[model samples]
Target: MHISEGVLSPPVLITGAAITLVGTWIGLKNTKAQQVPLMAVLTSTFFVASLIHVPLGPSSVHLVLNGLVGILLGFGAFPSILIALLLQALFFQFGGIIVLGANTANMALPAVIVYLLFKKLCISEKRRNRIIGGFLSGSISIILSGTMVALCLFFTGSNFNHAAKTVLIAHVPIMIIEGIITALVVDFIFRVKPEMLLGTEH
Candidate 1:
């Protein structure tokens, strides 16, 4: 759900840039030296996951894996997502430079919200609870990101209203797919390496 450069107005772009800067700063400040490796690994996961796009009716969607990153990184997801988006823009021009902050905010904000909302459930000792948390977080992240994209488009102009609605509808399947993938991933990681699940919020 990358918003292309020049698609948004100057005011929207400026607001996104300012908000994202604050988030990135907090993420950088809160990131611990020992956690750098984990952050790098999560960033790579996000970078790779969003590359393969699945064509939908009017647009294309991809696996953001933002929930997984959010659960594992907390506020750290901001910087991690920013770095991944930067690489995507630099090499592939996926989202472009001007809209980087807006795209970053769209994806990373949901993750941070998910972290706050479901951190305990995700890290719970109960497998079922963890799975439920994972599923919800994954699904919700996609939905929220789509909403943010729509909002950005709406703010750009009334002409984009139809496009905004279509974006949300196109992402329905993606939300389910991501939910299952995230749930399975969370379960596997919990079983294999429980300590790894102890994120920044813990």
Candidate 2:
């Protein structure tokens, strides 16, 4: 969800930027030189996925696939998401430079959380466990991200209450779609390119 510029309070924007800075630093630290290329590819995928979104009041609805990216990239998702969002802001002007941090934090934080919470399950030996892990990661990340976006708006002012609720409600369908997509993608990757997943980096 891309929260438009000037919608958030200054404190919220600053907090988001600070959080993203730390997350990106950790992401880069965890990223091996060998994974750089894969990181770029996933960044591109994330960039393209949100290109055709339906705008809600302060945010937008679209396929984030953050959980998919998270399970694969782990902490690497921070930099991946930041770069992609930077390009989107620069080229399409989807979100402004001022709001970039908040936007990045809103999405990437959930990705990191997903990785922390479910990466082990995603890389499990059993197919069923991996599938369930993938599904949860996909679905829960959306809920987390949507909640974050909603809170950002809600904290901005009472005037944004409706918009905040709307943002959460609109993403319900996307959560399910992302869950199914992530499940299939994770299972397919486990079979075709296992090395790409987080726990398999070794």
Candidate 3:
């Protein structure tokens, strides 16, 4: 779901950069010193997971894992995702440097939102509830990210309406795939390493 460079207007790009900077600052400030290692691991996980793309009609989709990051990291997901995106842009050119902030914000904001909404369920003792939380968090994150991407494109020009729709539609399977993967991962972590989740208080 990376938006290439030069596709967005200057205002949108500038606004995105400013918002991401503030968000990353807040994320870093709130993240516990003890959680830095976990954050780094999750950042690498996101960076690698998104590299394996599945071909779609003309475009392709990849595993974002943003939902899992959000569930575990909360607002801290912003900085973690930003770092991964930066590497992807610099090393693989998966996305452009110009749109880095917009892409980071678009993906990370939903993660934070889902984390807040589903944090309780994710940490619940019941397996069923945690599973539901993971599925919803994973699925909704992709949906929201796709919508955010479309909205960004919408602001650029009316010609992008069809492209926006296509992007959203192509990600339907990704939503499901991410949902299942997130549920499995969350369940495993809860059982084997509950402290890894946000609000666990070590």
The residue-by-residue lDDT of candidate 3 on 1-202, one tens digit each, is: 8899999988888877887888899999998898899789879988888877856567776778899889988889899999999999899887788899999999999999999899889889999999999999999998999898988888889899999999889778889888888888898999998887745573
lDDT tens digits, residue span 1-202, model 2: 7888988999999999998999999999988898788788888988888765755457765778888878878788889989998998889888889899999999889998998899889889999999999999999999899999999999899899999999999778788878887898899998888887734445
User: Compared with the true structure, what per-residue lDDT tens digits does model 1 show for residues 128-188?
Assistant: 9999999988999988988989999999999999999999897788998888888888888
Q: Which pairs of residues collide in model 3?
A: none
What is the C-alpha local distance difference test score of each model? 0.87, 0.87, 0.88
After superposing candidate 1, which stretches have Cα over 4 Å from the reference?
A: 52-61, 199-202
TM-score, predicted candidate 3 vs. hidden true structure: 0.92
lDDT of 1: 0.87
**Model 3: which ten-residue window has the lowest total lDDT?**
193-202
Total colliding residue pairs, candidate 3:
0
- What is the Å distance of residue 53 in model 1 from its true position? 6.2
Backbone collisions counted per model? 0, 0, 0
By lDDT: ranked, best first:
3, 1, 2
Candidate 2 structure lDDT:
0.87
